[model samples]
Target: MTHPLVKRYNLAPHPEGGFYRQVFRSENETSSYIHGETRPALTHIYFLLLKGKVSRFHRVLHDEVWNHYEGAPLQLFQLHQQQLWERRIGGQGNEYAEVVNAGNYQAAQSMGEYSLVGCTVAPGFDFADFSFIEEPAMKQWLDIAHPDLAKFI
Candidate 1:
């Protein structure tokens, strides 16, 4: 069955997996203090994950803040600075909002039936600044940094 969020937002298939719709993109532009890439000041989007679907490991040049809206919780995994970390978002034990820093490889999956969440990116989100990590690379990194999370990737 189609998730309500997908219908409500008219979400489309995301390359990483799941579904998403770009909801807001600021017209303001600025050079990234970290990456030095020029982009919008802020960008917002609705992201939805259904059971059995995952947002594959990927990285964005800007910091992203995720806000929980409704439905199931999500587990967000990040690989950064040679370390692996996982954070829960939108569940009883999780924070309603969480941040994934710039340059960190991040991914997420629903913990139950479905999850509807929003993501805001500082310095905006651009396809040129997005990158998906290859499976072998992710496996090797996970094996060393977070062996327990290897199965998810």
Candidate 2:
């Protein structure tokens, strides 16, 4: 069955898993300072996750903020320099918005049937700046460091 967000936003399969549609892209370009290059100032997307689906661990060059719009709560996990942080993005959680820092490995999934969320990226998002942690490498890292945190991936 198609989720309402999938239908409304014309979301497509995202490399990270689940579905997403790019809804906004800034016209102005800005220097990242860190990247030492000019890029879109910002970008926005509508992201959807269905039950049993998870957004695989990945990292981007720019910070991302997620806004809970509707549906069930979503679990977001961030692996930062070997530290694991968990946050719920919806429902009765203390926060409805969460930020994932640039260069940190992050992932997410729906707690129920589905979750409709929005993501905003500063410095925009380019495929060239995206990196996915392969399962093999992740398993190896988890085996020695964060075995208990593997479930989030």
Candidate 3:
């Protein structure tokens, strides 16, 4: 059976993983400092990750802030400067919100049955600015440098 929250939010399978529904997109556009291109000022979406599913490592040209809403805590993993780190969102003693800076690779999964989070992107979100870590060399590097986190890829 489909998850109740997935049905309630009318989410669709995301290319990266899990399910999501875009809830807001700014009507205004501006030149993005990070991308040096004109884009929507902001965009928001509801992202849900099921226990067994994963949000594959990917990078975007804009900063994304994730806000926890319900269900289990989300284990957000980020790769920056060849370092892998994790942040838990929506659990006791964990942050309610966390940010993934532009150009940083990130992935996530639910710590329990499910995790629902609200993601807000500055300079907006466009598939054109998104990229998955599909390079064989990069995967090999991750395996060597952070074997534990390679599973996320």
Candidate 4:
């Protein structure tokens, strides 16, 4: 299947598996069919793919700027370091995504892994875009949300 957006911002692995290996990654850990490199122009960049319903409790470590490149709509959530104002991000399609307020939104697209293009005001990125919820709930959600995909991650 050919996607126009893919052609629009064409990027490939510098050396197949280079980035993954550098981070000691695995197809199991992150359901990444392919991982995009760190953008030079951007201070921090992480392009990842999740197989199914993903509910994370983490928020942007810093003020984040994001755009979805492919896949389905990604839900982004955040609670500022010292504020209670919550934010949510969701829209249809992957053609363009730039949410002004970052908060507690579900990156729940239909199916298939979605591409998330984002950079934080701080380099505290990488896996820094994380939120850890308690067990049982997290685990149970994984089982029901992403039956097949959950076992691997």
- How accurate locally, in lDDT, is each candidate? 0.86, 0.86, 0.92, 0.37
Pick the TM-score winner.
Answer: 3
Q: How close to the true structure is residue 126 of candidate 2, measured as C-alpha lDDT?
A: 83
Comparing 1 and 3 on TM-score, the stronger one: 3
Candidate 3 lDDT over 33-144, as tens digits, reads: 9768888999999999999899999998889999999999999999876788899999899989999999899999999999999999999999989999977988998999
Give candidate 3 regions above 4 Å deviation.
none
The TM-score values for the models, in the order shown, are 0.88, 0.90, 0.95, 0.37
lDDT of 3: 0.92
Q: In model 3, what is the error at residue 62, expressed in angstroms? A: 0.8
Q: Runs in model 4 with CA error above 4 Å?
A: 1-42, 53-55, 77-95, 99-113, 126-131, 134-153
Q: Predict model 4's lDDT versus the native.
A: 0.37
Superposed on all Cα atoms, model 4 deviates from the true structure by an RMSD in Å of: 11.3
lDDT of 2 by residue, 1-116 (tens): 77777887899999889999999999999988567688799999999989988998899889999999988999999887667788998998458899999888898999999999
The RMSD (Cα, Å) of candidate 3 is 1.1
Q: Which pairs of residues collide in model 3?
A: none
Off by over 4 Å in 2: 134-138, 144-153
Best by lDDT: 3
Candidate 3's displacement at residue 100, Å, is: 0.4
